[model samples]
Target: MKKFFTSLQTKLVISFLLLILVITGGTFLITNTQSKKALLDSTRDDMLQTVALVSTQFTAADLQTLSGFKAGDDGSPAYLSMIRRLRDMRSLSPNMVNFYIMSIAGNNISFVVDDAVSGPALVGDVYTDPDPRLFDAVAAPSVSDNFYTDAWGTFISAYAPLKDANGNTAFVVGGDMDASQVITRQNFIGTTIYYIMAGAILFAGFMIAIFSVTIIKDIKKLDKTADEISKGNTKVSVDVHRSDEIGDLADSFGRMVASLKIMMDMDEQPGDK
Candidate 1:
């Protein structure tokens, strides 16, 4: 056991294994972090694009009329038509959770148009959330950074502005996507990366084990040759053909044996002695 541990083959295998571990660990960490960031950023950009597309479906007049919409008045032709248009826009993307139009009056914001099924805020209900960023959506060039949560679920939201004929902001069109989907996708990617790293480590270990066996076999052959030469069997020759350090050692060993044989021959000659 002690000889096995001190063997060159064992040392080489251990060194390679440690190197693979370090490199694999570092690569997995970097790749996992970057992949998560990239995935979330892609999702955010898609949500923003959805907001922009949904905003275009409604004209300034449509937004202006919907701002005064009252709850329980779903029978109104204009309200029904607006809901149909919003649903159509929502259908374009499977990731979209909800699409709606909101009006900001002073510090108060109210829902203008929304699908009937997921209605939390009535048409005229005042939003009392402490977040002041909701008001910024009135003229927001792109999506709002602030997320929203309610009884329905947590969401990442985006908002775009609707402008009247006079270029005055009329309403803000917004869309929501489930935040859980992003989290789930990130988890899935991280797990896949971990598995790949683990597989690489295992394969490296297997190859190292195989290589160690071959090297140890060559070393044993050299040891046996040395044993034979020590016992005065100087005719024994090591047949190592590799072009490595082991091969060099074998060549040197062969030369020493040849020299020992010449010395023994010279001593046996009566005149030379």
Candidate 2:
């Protein structure tokens, strides 16, 4: 076993195999990380686009519709019908969990929820715990902001404030859409593909190194050495028998033995150390 390990063929095979393993492992890690980043980036872009589309639908004219229902001056079946219609519009988008319109002037908010757990019961409630940024957005008459919450399966919550016909910040029309599944699935697929490719490359490299070093190269060297030995040189130097280091050492020992034999045959005196 020790001799086998010291042979050039064995050393070459081991070194090649180790190199292949490292390269393959590194490739897998890099691909995996890149894939994850790409997927998340894609999800973020999609969410952004969706939010922009939803916000665009909230205009000054739309705020007028909500304002009528908020003030008792326009309390009628038509106003109720309009609110229901707005809620229906919010529900039309499958990605959206809920849509809300907040009245910054009245400090009142109304919401329509598609998620059963966080449904419309929370609608028509006032927000006393006001965020200054949120208020500013509603005041801007077209303020858009993005928010995230892990509680509702990690959604990108967005709001775009709209002004009334009088150019006053009257309301914000915004919605929350779930991103957990979309983002998570992307991550999973990217990770899986990265690992698969990595494993395949590692396996292929290992096979190539093993076959080339231990089998192909070693066999060629062995055949060359055999031909040299067959030339019938007695007291052959093992070094000249092959091009490997092992062959060189063996040849040196062979030459030494040959010299010793010739000296003994000559009846040399034992004065030589």
Candidate 3:
């Protein structure tokens, strides 16, 4: 076992493996990073477009009615209608986890209508410490740059304003997607990269092993033939059959052996030939 590990073949195999690891690992990392960014950017655009499309379904009057209600009024007919409408709209896009409206008043953002369908937030509930991006959304459609943390944990989101009759911003409609979706996909990309890396290393090791063994085996044969010649044996032949450097060395050694036999014949006396 020790002899095998210390052999030239093993050393060459290890060297090639290291090179393959560095090159394949670098490319895998770069690809993983780019794939993650592209997935997030694409998801952000899709979510933004989702919220934008959903915003068009609501008029300012729908939000205007719900904007005045308090916590206990969450079960009101108008609010329930809004909830049903939001849920129906949400069903069309399963990736969208939730849809709601937040009325923007200076720095104060309050929930007007949210269709969570479970433990829903009440009307007129103030959003605690809202992200400043929500305010920007009141002017134009805007989305979070990536998955971001809020009172509800991390999620990718987009927001667009619902316009009133006077063309003023009534409320900002928002859409949400679970952060786990992005995480799951990123994990997938990393996993794929690792698989490819493993396969690449194995292939490199296999090829290097074949090459190293071929050269070493030929050299060993040459060494054995030389030892036989040193002991005065001239009938043994250098039997290597390759076209590479080792083949050339074998050819040269064979010629030397042949010339030695010719010289030995010439040196013989008539009776000693």
Candidate 4:
């Protein structure tokens, strides 16, 4: 086996196989990344469009209409009612985890959860100045925005600026879905491709090993003949009949042994006669 590996032809075959595997692995990784990115981007767009439609029902102008609402009140009836409305809209989409309406000036967060697992601990939380990055990016433009953050445990969030009838940005509307959703899908795909490629490599290696063994056995015969000739036995002949390079090598070795045998015979005949 070691001798076979030392052969130039065997080394070339091994290198070619390795190169193929490297190229295939890189292509798989690139394909996985592109597919995952496209899926996440499409989901983000759909979520933002849903938020826009739902916002139509709960406009910035309607904030004043929500009665009995105080600026600093927590769990107030008006606030709870708005949260319930937000939760109802989110229930329509399984992918939507939670949505929040944040007051730009007061910095109060009013959130609604489709499920208790979604945002139970953050329903009526108030931050003095909630994560300035979120405020700056989410509230700057009226256009929908997307961002990723680990502050709230790795979430992919989309924000849309809300404008009242007076054409002023009152609060920022934001929604968060888990980032791991996309990654999970990618992992599954990668695992599947890995198994498939591994199987292919194993099959190809088995075939190559079988053929290499046959070639190596023939070469070993040639080595045996050379050992015999070196020990003063020059009558042994190689029986290789193939047209390959290994066969040509064996034929040349056989011809050299025949020539040596003739010379030995001529020297012995002179002494006997």
Per-candidate clashes, comma-separated: 0, 4, 0, 0
Tens-digit lDDT track for model 1 on 30-148?
Answer: 99999998887888788878787776777766866776577776668888888888888788887887877777777778777776365545676666652344566677646535455
The predicted structure with the larger TM-score, 2 or 4, is: 4
Off by over 4 Å in 2: 3-25, 59-61, 68-93, 103-118, 124-147, 166-169, 213-273
Please give the distance, in angstroms, between residue 109's alpha carbon in candidate 4 and its true position after superposition.
6.5
Model 4 worst lDDT window (10 residues): 137-146
What overall lDDT, based on C-alpha atoms, would model 3 receive against the true structure?
0.83
| Candidate 4 local lDDT, 1-273, one digit each (tens) | 358658854875687578767877787778777766676678767766776666567655465644234455445666666777777877886676777666555445443222234445344345442444456534442322333554355666656666667766666666667667756766787787778778877787677667766786787788788888789786688877778898888788888888888888888788764
Give the residue spans of candidate 3 off by over 4 A.
1-7, 264-273
- TM for every model, in the order presented, reads 0.79, 0.55, 0.88, 0.67
Clashing pairs in 1: none
What is the full ranking by lDDT, best candidate first?
Answer: 3, 1, 4, 2
Local lDDT at 113 for model 3:
83
User: How accurate locally, in lDDT, is each candidate?
Assistant: 0.77, 0.55, 0.83, 0.63
lDDT of 2 by residue, 1-273 (tens): 238878666777777777766876777677777776666566546544554465566666656555555334223665555456556665666666665556555544444222233433333555554333455456432222333443334455555556555765566665555566656676787768767877786787767766655454545544554455456333433334555664575566556656655665456556653
Give the lDDT of residue 35 in candidate 3: 89
Model 2 earns a TM-score of 0.55
Q: What is the lDDT of candidate 4?
A: 0.63
Clashing pairs in 2: 237-251, 238-251, 239-247, 239-251
Model 1: per-residue Cα lDDT at residue 63: 62
